[model samples]
Target: MIAGREVAGFSDREIADLLAPLRPAAPDSTENATRRDAFADAVWSCLVEPGDATAGVLRLALGPAAALVALDESDAVVERRLTDAGVPDPSRLGLAAARARWAPRAVEGRLRGAFRSARVMGVRLVVAGDPEWPGGLSDLGAHGPAALWVRGDPGVLVSGPSVALVGCRAASAYGEQVAAELADGLVSRGFAVHSGGAYGIDGMAHRAALAAEGTTAAVMAGGVDRLYPAGHHDLLSRVAARGAVVSELPCGTSPSRWRFLQRNRILAALTAATVVVEAGHRSGALNTAGHAAALGRPLGVVPGPVTSPASAGCHRLLRDGGAVCVTSADDVRQLVMPTLDLGGDAGPLRLPPEQLRVLDALSSRRPRDEAAIAASSGLSAERVAGVLAVLELDGRAVEGEGGWLRGRG
Candidate 1:
């Protein structure tokens, strides 16, 4: 075993006392959480950041307890075990590098301090074996959390189907309104609302869920004890009281940019589907939508005015067929609920009314000259010429010896 892992690992008595909050409050309630599982998972959670698939693979190959013991092994031993476990590493150097990252955080004191802080802050830990762990998160494969540091009822994570409402931080009023209404509607019908508790659309969604007396889970980038955006402290506290404020990080860990990006995956994974209310061409919410798509979770986007830059990302998703256009809660429901029609095409293609009138002037069966078609369609000759050219390019109009007519089906 490596130098300190044997001495640095938490003892059973220490772990049992530190993780008592994770156990069921009811005397007769059945839950399998134990000191060994909670402590090892907590050690791993602090050892790696969110979405560390390497840690996940290790924990799975040798259960969390054995994995903790193995972390103290030589780099060669860990590497060989990883290789035998079928983790891809053409160079066989990934485990060695991961050792460098994990070594500094493998101390038992730091692990104990995290649990102690959580106890003082009323935070609870939940591991994968717990019944309260959201099953939807298993879809993350090797990127699933090592353990969850949560405030509020963990049961909320497992209860009912959930929808993620995420978008830009500087969302427009229209975006916020749409997000709130969507949350309200989904919650009224028994869906829990989920989002990162950011300012604009995310805050709107959470507040709406609360207003509707529905549960909402906020997956934080920082530790649950250290709520990042001070502005939303009260809101998040309410969520923790009524629902959940959860993270993979231990107490005292602050938020970072990379952590924020990685955090999007949990928001995507914990829900049945994701809806991006409004986002810029480069919004982080697009990252969440991408994760959802990668997980095969249904992704929906609300359309914005053609002029709004805030909605550009959503429009891009629709145009690229990365998301289905969803305008209402009903549209979102169709994504997760069964016995619903495959939704219709997205927002209408913006076309000039005069162009439609001009196109209408030409029949698929008959053809007419520009002047005649212009007179029939109540358009000037110049307008008719431009419209016909555009229509022809779009395969909506065809020109022949007779003149112009609608294209064939």
Candidate 2:
């Protein structure tokens, strides 16, 4: 159902296992001699499949296919972009049924036309053999994207143990603080921060990781290059510069509320654990937490003051036995750090006040100018600029053509 079509019998996890081998060879990965032999075998299998839409989708998704093509007006309601490679034509059966009502050339024309700009676009297609692919998401199986249009770096996907922190987009000030503090503590302990890249807690996680000069991952509902919520463009650009912004959706695609629903699944599955800093009763962050529970991933909720509506969902999670309450970064790391065994105990982590001042000027999703940093942190432009230089040297901040942003180290 996640592919916008039905695939009976096989669970998503089973499907993820089937495609697990294809990750290293992401969409843009180059084909080699061994790969050629495999491709030949896969396509032939697709072409020879007994006539059926379910088999058609499986064939396109697995091998002997380059894309699944569907005709549509805009990128959002993708009619199809099914890539099925075969020694014989795989489209004959499906096209035959639909063509009786439409034109055969029109069907073929649609596939060819979509492929035209798609090549220039370099739609990310992670073959089973690509490097830099994240196998964690393969757990989603048929529900996962046929291939991800990854922006930033694929290395970040599997670079280290990651913890996703999500919350309400309309987060309270304390919620934002928890998000930032959680991110800071996570990075300090050596876990890469991951989130949906939304406003509120998600944005704060990215910004905090940058402030800490630690790696962070931003998962998107749309194309990585497009950067939805256009307001976060600058913050996202910083993420791309420092860590990565990944998307299961292809480039040129736009986000929808429906897509956002599934996007949380990808976010939840990709990390060692998930932490909800704040959320209202219906916040998407809570949805993400539910996905984590269903997927059997560890779920943590940050406790907030009793009065805030933003923390209500978290309180509910605690009440329902859905999540464990985490009051500090130590609580989070104790639950998820063993997978990578970061050994954060080698020494005490430290950050100078000068660095903190610079970081104080940054937001989880907002950038600040030298003057702004000075005013907010109560330091002189000269003083703030000097501290920025020191922070950059320390790998805590970065200077760019646009301005300084929390560096994603």
* TM-score of every candidate relative to the true structure: 0.79, 0.61
**Which run of 10 residues does model 1 get worst, by summed lDDT?**
1-10
Candidate 2 per-residue lDDT, tens place, 1-409, comes to: 1133212222334333333333334333433333342332222222221123433344345442222222212222222333323224434435434323323323333433332333444333343344665766655553544445455566787777789999999998899988898899989887899998898889999999999999998888876657868999999888988888877554455788877887888898888789999998899998898777766566888888888888889999887653667888887875453222345354323345455545535542456678877765667789988888887886567777667776644
lDDT of each: 0.80, 0.63
Residue-pair clashes per candidate, as listed?
0, 30
lDDT of 1 by residue, 332-364 (tens): 876554223335433223245465556545655
Candidate 1 stretches with Cα past 4 Å from truth are 1-8, 25-34, 83-93, 338-409
**Best-fitting candidate, scored by TM-score:** 1
RMSD of 1: 12.6
Candidate 2 least-lDDT 10 residues: 42-51
Question: Which regions of candidate 2 are displaced past 4 Å?
Answer: 1-127, 338-409
* Clash list (residue pairs), candidate 1: none
